[model samples]
Target: MQKDIYVVGLMVDERSTKAPDVQQVITRYGSNILCRNGIPSPSRERGIITLTMEAAPNEYEKMEQELKNLHGVTVDCIHFSQQESFQVCQK
Candidate 1:
């Protein structure tokens, strides 16, 4: 098994999709959103949504691929924390 990862999802829309649109993405990806922020987009009718989530290491790639394919949703970045391995000292 791989180490757990932290993923950030950004919803950038040229034209905002409704609630169903956003929900659909979450459902499809099975991602647990940790935090979210929304702001009005100056260039278009849509707004930008930023979200953070914890992803299962094994499933990270699949989740990212699915999310990117969703309408009005794009992954801005994916961040991961290195898991340190420790060993017991023997006398």
Candidate 2:
């Protein structure tokens, strides 16, 4: 089966009020996360966070829903498949 790559973008208007909650939710699904990047405004009032991940459709939707449920936070995601089967390769 093919696996899709999902990129989730999060924007928080109230950083101090919402960032910790967002982080906690992200941490809850850490195993599905491939990478995470966050940028905070100089004044710390707002911020943007990006997460790159590979997970089952249900898992991805669960994460998205959790983030969306947070107050003062906006979430968006893009997912695509490269026509390649997903596999785990160990070194």
lDDT of 1 by residue, 1-91 (tens): 4554454545656644544566566666554556666676667766666656666655655666666776666665556645643222111
Q: Each prediction's Cα RMSD?
A: 8.8, 7.0
Error of 2 at 71 (Å): 0.8
Alpha-carbon lDDT, every model: 0.58, 0.81
lDDT score of model 1?
A: 0.58
Q: lDDT value for candidate 2?
A: 0.81
In candidate 2 the C-alpha lDDT for residue 57 amounts to: 72
Instruction: Estimate the TM-score of every prediction.
Output: 0.57, 0.82
Clash totals, every prediction: 0, 0
Tens-place lDDT per residue, model 2, 27-75, is: 9989989999999877878899999988777787788888888988888
Which residue ranges in model 2 land beyond 4 Å of their true spot?
A: 82-91
